[model samples]
Target chain A: MSLQRPNEKLKSDVLIGVGLRHQHFTEALTTPSNIDFVEVHSENFFAQGGATQSVLAQASEKYAISLHSTAMGLGSAQGVPSQYLQKLKQLASTCNPILMSDHACFSWSQLNGQQVHAGDLLPLAYSEQTLMVLAHNIDRVQQSLGRSLLVENLSAYIQYSHACMPETEFLVRLAELTGCKLLVDLNNIIVTANNINAAQPLDYAQQWLAEIPTTMVGEIHLAGFTEVKEGELIIDDHSQAVSSQGWQLYRSALERFGKIPTLVEWDNNLPSWHTLVAEADKARMIAEQVFGDNHSSKVTTAMTGLESEFIHE
Target chain B: MNNNDAKKHSLQAAFEQVAQQQQTLISAIFPSADSEVIDEFDPRGMAIYRNNLLATAQQALAISFPTVLTLIGEGLFNYASRELLISSPPKHGDWALWGDDFPSLLTNLAQLSDYPFVADIAQVDRLRQQSMRAKNSVIEQASLQLLATHDIDEIYIELTTSQFGLNSNYPVIEFWLSHQQRVVSDTAEELNQKFIQQSLDKLVQGDFSQKVLIYRPYYNAEIRELSASEYAWLTLIKQGVSIGKALDIMTNNNELEHDFDFAQWIGIALEQNLINHLKV
Candidate 1:
């Protein structure tokens, strides 16, 4: 079955949003901001009741909610847990999120006959078998949610020897098979390239982005990476500001894919709400520069239902 | 081989290889059986992922067991969390659901032998965390009419799903309350020592046992101390016992200093949202 997009209207504008961390929840709900939407880690709000749901409800009242999960582990051979899907469905029903997404890595595997979560995104080999697993899980999730899922590419630290295809080709095929869209995380591409010692990581990422069909791409994610000592890996820790290289890569993305709803994801060493918003504003300015004035002006229509409800409340 | 059969064999081989590789990589991350699981991948990259898993597990435990962290200090807490993560990695993707084994780990630690109250406090933290995540309850006031209309022997009082009870030998409820502020910075050793001394002093002077009731009456979980008789009464009610039978158990027990007052206890339980409803 073909998965339907969560919102058709979202495709019209160059919308920019920020990952809504808990520190900025009060300000995000209480104050008006320039952002078009707010993306939250779906697992963070998984609790059945109490403050999490209440906070999510208040946040939904103010802005469009994007449910980005880290642990769906769509590439896992063991399959997504039924309880996890149930909780996610309940959360989606509660907020009616504008977008739902998860990483394209496997975090669930069996150890000693017991299924366990690695607690971090573990890289998957680019093979037909892995692709099939991802497609099956994605189809199941889409069927459960009755919408398309946006699968983000992982910044894999290690490479498998027996991979059958390039990451881009694998992702494209995944989208084709499952009718799911891809959440192209630009920084993850650069991080992966740089870790493998690509001569020009930025150019490599642009080349990577060139492979995916533009229509299959749903959203863009811009994040900063942590630079370790020389000879050490540059981790996708999302701690600092987006690098000069990252922006250039993002520019290439906008040039190639046109304006897509983008998110500024700074998950660690979190800055103030103002700083986070400034990062989103920077993304918006870049998108404006790429798509010109009319596209940025169209972003005002992104939060369709919440704006009036927010004002009335 | 035929074309379709050849494709099927190739796909099966690929699936087996991928599954085997993931199992090796995950086992290496937690380092249980094989130390040389990094032969296929870059050792440096594998180490980074391994460290990430430990940090993730540690951070999750810190959030759920803030009181334990504050009481034990950051150094010890991190070490314990890392050890637990290595021994039994998170089975649940959500960290909140993964740390139920943590209090038991605290109980089993040899280093914490001197601080006997630590395990009980950890249990309290776990219960509070569980209570917070418990489904929202609407106390069924309409069902209370069953208590008045039906014979006491036929009536059963149901407690909210969020309610839990813990009976500890040490005065853990007091210790848990005293260490509510979660220390983000490295907890000073001297502070832990001082707290330990105070806890030991309180342990010597305070009652030998404390019955703690943790329940989310509204949005937040509240910890309330229960008398022995009250704890016994609630334990009976929670066991699907009829209200008359529970009262009989409390009344027949000679350990109590005073008589069990069903009316007074019901009033308090209703007020505190401990009772979901009285059913017949």
Candidate 2:
């Protein structure tokens, strides 16, 4: 039930990976040569008897893995859902993922007498009020999960008028008060800055990362977005390839945070397995360039036996 | 409650209210919701989140009931799914096993009156999803020799949680298989319409009975057709009845006019790897 088992060997340097989408599961079973790790949405594998679990068991044999979730509702008033946390803890124990994380926003709320899932990640106000809420829920989650979890900052569409504290201070305070680290999604920062007219988007992202030191970042996520509504709002749809601007900010983030575990999060319009591995390779190249010889071989000697047979292919 | 507890409660209450109402969430959080807002805070921004929430629920339904979508066509299927979202939002964050109520909801749709069989057929898809999610029992291999060794009255058979058999008045199996994408017919629409008519004709002729057995022997969903009496015997075994009691019930039941061969049914079940194991 203990959670702090970091893969120091793999975590020795920045490792690259992609979200394990269903389209890529079969090819992933082939255990391609380049993938450093594979991350699966925790909710998808909650059911123990489905094909998702069978496929994940085979994939975990050959590749390093992580567990990312969007249903934690870290800011909900209904307290922590023991059932959701129970299943998540089971999956984490079974897989022993390199890292476990969920969004920093609320997705559950109490409506009348029933607990309702908002069906999407809803933004939380970055004021003194929500800061305490998020911290308390994170403590409960970390206690039950038996690990220090990582929380990703959300991409907001509107700034809160009543939220007295800035978003950076809120994230910093959460990490300081509770033991959880930040998941630092680079693309979300870009999308939010452009939509909300924060100074220059990349500069805004760099400034935010500057506030949190390298030790506090657990992981980084890069996903795609498109500006719709006459270029007024940038939606994090995850359907397209990551934009050129996103890549630039990603490089800046790597320079700021040094070498943290990074992932390409293409959730919707998923590409073929080969194409996804290539995107992970692209993240690898950026990390290598930024860190400058602080990294090891691109394809490390982690797999043997059956993994060797397929990865070599 | 302490100040922190009270603050959290108010934040959650406000959030729950905004989810049900219009995107007044922005206005509640920031007065920018009312003004010609700044670049990042468009009033229409809430609509995008609204669409994403609806789309998430729709995609979940579409995944669970792909055949139903093909039967109703994508456009109308999208319409029906959205309507269901309006009528019933998800009550929890864990939606992996959601959409069990969808088949009943589909049957109540006024637009689907012409395709009354669609709802019943959709039930098969739900069964398949459930069967896939059912706990996989690690059963020792079942053998007729082992089963024969026990006195029929004294023996009990353990069935896996992943098996289901249903007998319906509609040609549910035919309707389901006809809509599956594997059939490779360019005129699938025309074929579906013809199959629908034939299914209805069979129903009117009082010969439209379809028997289906769904199970997840392996990790994947496996479905096959069964004979009428075979369905009855399997249902009895699934209910934990002793083999002797099951046979007696089958023999005593005068309600079923069409008879089935037990030996042939056992052979079918064994070949399909349907039974989990034998017990005494």
Candidate 3:
């Protein structure tokens, strides 16, 4: 059977947002609703009761909320632990998020019978065995939430030789089995492609894109990556602005995906709010250039912040 | 186990090998502890996972126990936290509760002996964090009525889950009180200078013994010194003692030893919301 696809939710235009950051909490609340939605990590609001929940409520008030998670180890061999799942479910019900997403990697594993949290997303082997486990876990999460989830790919530094299938193929099979959506993170694809020396990386990206049905991809993630001192590995640290190679790849993704909801995620070395808003505007402008013919009038109406009355000086 | 169980067990076993033991996963793409690099991938690739684990543990400890970090300097703190990371990795995905046993790290390190109270401060840090984030129980209507109707000998009293007490040989409460600013933003060197300028040694100089009472003060943990009878009564109640025996010791009405103002004591307990309420 073919991969199940959800109906398009947002208007085909207005395709970009910046992840809501506590550093930019003041600005996020005050800044005009230029972006479509603000994504917050679901685990941050797991407290019994605290100010962080109120901050999230305020952010939700201004823009649509996307509960992006980092800790739910969906690819775990044992399974997603029930406690983390319960917390995420509560957050989902509370926020009524527009979209929820997490990495297609394991961050928790069972040592004997005890569940241990890795706290960072660990890559999985791209084999059918691994795929089966991941598919089962993803289905569990989606069923429990009563909503579809968009699982992103891992920017793995190492690959497993036993991974008989390619990463793209694994994801395609996972989506077909679980009815899950994909949040294709371009920078991760770029980072992994470069690190793997995939001959022609862009063609490889296009090749992977070709293998997966575009309808299954619900969102796009653009983030900055840093290369280590030895230059052998490009770490997806999400520290800086999106690189030129990353931006070019985004254009390719936009050309193929056709203006899906995109997010600019900068977690470390956080820039000022103005700088982040500019990055969101850049993504919007790029998408406008790609889909300008059908979406020009909508783009004019979406003029916000610097793109509007403030600066053209 | 079935085939699915076998495959799942194997996956978890391999994941634990890397995550818990810091050993490389035995994948051809990763080095097998020995430097056998694959054809295209670099051997250093596995270092990324190791580095990610380190950064994650380090950052979690940084937020949960900022007081420890501030007291011991960043370099030493990071070093100690890394050691603690390997020894006691996170049990749950909640980073807020990740460093639950970090105080033991401070108490065990020999280099930190000069500041014996630092471990207590770490505990204070944890309790403060828990108190601030967790909603405290309100005074239970049933509990108050039950307490009012029943004589001290007729009922058993218990402290709320939010109340904690530490009887330390050192004046830890004063030391903890001196450093309880909610946020620990100062560098260790700066904090050390402040510690010296305030002659903080005096806090620990007295009989060098004290009892510290910890309970929810509004949303955060409030650290205060306990009176002789308050401390005795709480200890007895905490041990599940019947109120009669505790009262005998508290007021010496049965000539047990001493005397306390029972009416004033109950009023204070009611005001502080320290008495446990019925669970249902």
Q: Residue B63, candidate 1: how far off, in angstroms?
A: 1.1
DockQ measured for candidate 1: 0.65
Which residue pairs of candidate 3 clash?
none
C-alpha-based local distance difference test score of model 2: 0.74
Error of 2 at B4 (Å): 12
Give the per-residue lDDT digits (tens) of candidate 1, residues A1-313: 2223355323336778889999998998887677878999999989887788889999877777899999998888778999999989999999888889999999888887778898888999898788877787899999999989999999888998888899999999999999888999999998889899999887798889989887888899999988878788888999988777777777778888886789999999999887787777667767776777754443332444423422232
DockQ of every candidate structure = 0.65, 0.35, 0.33
| lDDT accuracy of residue B72 in candidate 2 | 89
DockQ of prediction 2:
0.35
Per-model TM-score on C-alpha atoms: 0.89, 0.86, 0.80
Tell me which of candidates 2 and 3 scores higher on DockQ: 2
Q: Candidate 1 on B1-280: residue-level lDDT in tens?
A: 9998997787677557667778888888875534455456898898888889878878888888989998899999988987787567788789888788888888888889888778888898889888888878777879988876999999998888888999898877667766764453445445555666766776787457779999886888889888888888888998999999888878888897465688998888777778877788
Model 1 ranges with Cα > 4 A deviation: A1-12, A294-313, B1-13, B33-38, B181-202, B205-207
lDDT of 3 by residue, A1-313 (tens): 1112233323336457788878899888986645777889888888866567778878777777788999887887657788888989988778778888998987665433445677777788786667767887898888888878899988988776667888888898898999888999988888788888888877777777777787888889989977666467888899999876667778778788775789999999999987887787677777776777445323433456534322221
Q: List clashing residue pairs in candidate 2.
A: A195-B40, A196-B40
Q: Specify the poorest-scoring 10-residue window by lDDT in model 2 chain B.
A: B26-35
Candidate 2 vs candidate 3: the TM-score winner is: 2
Say what the interface RMSD of candidate 3 is.
5.0
CAPRI tier for the interface of model 2: acceptable
lDDT of 2 at A214: 77
